[model samples]
Target: MNDNLAVLRGYFDAMKAGGPPAAMPFYAEDVVLEVPGAHPAAGIYRGHAGVGEFGATMARLTGGTFRLVPEDLLAGEEHVVTVATASANGVSWRRLILSTVRDGKLATVRFFEGDQALVDQVLSA
Candidate 1:
């Protein structure tokens, strides 16, 4: 695995081990997460605290049913693209996540979801 992939591996491992709190260590202090759509959980989150809040908000909106399962990882020097399946409220959608790595940590992430309307409907419901 490349360095970026390794970092993401650590991040995902942390998430699996202890949720967002554990994964915080793998993110840069000024990390940004951009979640798009017309749902309650859609927004731009900044820093570790913001990321935590985003996770919390999603969990609250989904009643803890929100889940992300990575199906593939394509890594370059500074970017890692994760092909993942995200599910919440019994609805699932594909997510193409582009994550930027800086200083051995995640600096930014933007998500492109397949079937945005379905995602919006499920999360908003």
Candidate 2:
């Protein structure tokens, strides 16, 4: 496994162990995070500050039930794609986050939600 892949693993492991704060160390200072859909948590988050804001926004949107559970991790030359499920209440939605890494830190993350309807319902509820 490469360093980027290892970082991806560590990110997920940390997320599982704790929460978003645990994974923030793996992100670059100028990291960009894109959360999809037309909900409260759907926006463009930038930098380490954005990481904390994004988590806080998600918590509020999901009423503190939102959780990311990674099911797969794929690594390329400069990217690591994590297939994770975002669950809230009894609804679970899958998403693919393509993370671009630079200097052992995640530079960007683009999220693709598998179940947009479910995501909408959960976040809009």
Question: CA RMSD for every model?
Answer: 0.8, 1.2
Per-model lDDT? 0.92, 0.87
Tens digits of per-residue lDDT, candidate 1, 6-72, equal: 9988888898999888888898999999999999999999998899899899989999999999988
Candidate 1: where are CA atoms >4 Å away?
none
Write down the TM-score for model 1: 0.96
Residue pairs in candidate 1 whose N, alpha carbon or C atoms collide under 3 angstroms: none
lDDT, candidate 2, equals: 0.87
Model 2: CA > 4 A from native: none
Residue pairs in collision within model 2: none
* Reference-based TM-score of each model: 0.96, 0.93
The ten-residue window of minimal lDDT in model 2 covers 15-24
